[model samples]
Target: MNMDTKSLLIDTSTILFQQKGYKSVGLNEILKACNVTKGALYHHFPNGKEELLITCLHSLNEVIITDIEAIFSRHLSTKEATISMIDTLIHQFEKDGTITGYTFSSIVSEMATMSEPVRNACGALYENIQNIYCKKLQADGFSNESATSIALFMTASIEGAMMLCLTQKSADPLKTIASLLPNLLNSLQ
Candidate 1:
């Protein structure tokens, strides 16, 4: 029950934070969303909102890392794996019909300046994602230096395309990136 309550709070808080910025979301809102009391929240997060935010960021990162790993594990080549990942993301957005955007972008944009821990957590997650891509590229036989550079570019490009897709209310940007990624990655070999 204790672990369930904590997970509930974290999951509820993540959705709220992703939909609404960190500054705009209140502890009361999170509490109400999860239907958990202050005592339970405080019991799990002794440091309060900042601590909760950090925990939420970590949770979100773990989910993304797991998804990326699964994609690589299932696919034979980095290019195929990356395209499959993008297809999954596009399918998700199309099904939801609303682009809630990435949690890392929302948190880093809103809270990074004021919270060092939040900033570090977001930064670490970003690096971990890039490393995943780098490892996949290396496995595909790219040189270390080239793989790292392409990984950085791929990560940044996908994030940027997501933002564009959200803003434009269309998945064209992502589709364009997805279509171009195979050629772009293949060019490096």
Candidate 2:
């Protein structure tokens, strides 16, 4: 088939999987939503749903890493970059009214245990995100050890905040984290 057909399948499947957990969304729904025949889907993804989900996760990982790197590039300090990234997230969460299916939490919660390949994709996504923060911190004069530790802490903190924001239906959690990051990072330095 063409690029558009393949993209339509991936894009539609990603949204369905994100909005509903992996177990909740069926391949038929994706096919129906995209108006593509099952034959077409199987042609693009021989392994079916598992392969599609893994591909979606990998694509999301690349997009997220690139966006995070861009955010870091625009800031001079790790604190600024961290806060800016969180702020951007908060804005998106507020605008979207619910977390988009793009986050690792959505995919991880549903399929991480059921599929090894998908779990590995989620793990890589988390690791790449953390590495972005680590590299930024290192550039701001933090040592390798400290940067790694801080990156882990920052990622966990922000991810947790995002979950809270989703459950609470407000961005208060993220805003609070953003407000406090400056003092917290300052103390680290």
Which candidate leads the pack in lDDT?
Answer: 2
Error of 1 at 55 (Å): 0.3
Q: Score every model by TM-score.
A: 0.92, 0.94
C-alpha lDDT of all candidate models, in order: 0.84, 0.84
User: Whole-model lDDT, candidate 2?
Assistant: 0.84
User: How do the residues 14-98 of candidate 1 rate in per-residue lDDT, one tens digit apiece?
Assistant: 8888877789999999988888889999999999999999999999988888878888889988899889988887887788754
Clashing pairs in 1: none
- Pick by TM-score: which candidate is best? 2
How many clashing pairs per prediction, in order?
0, 0
Global CA lDDT computed for model 1: 0.84
The C-alpha stretches of model 1 lying farther than 4 A from their native spots are 1-3, 99-103, 112-114
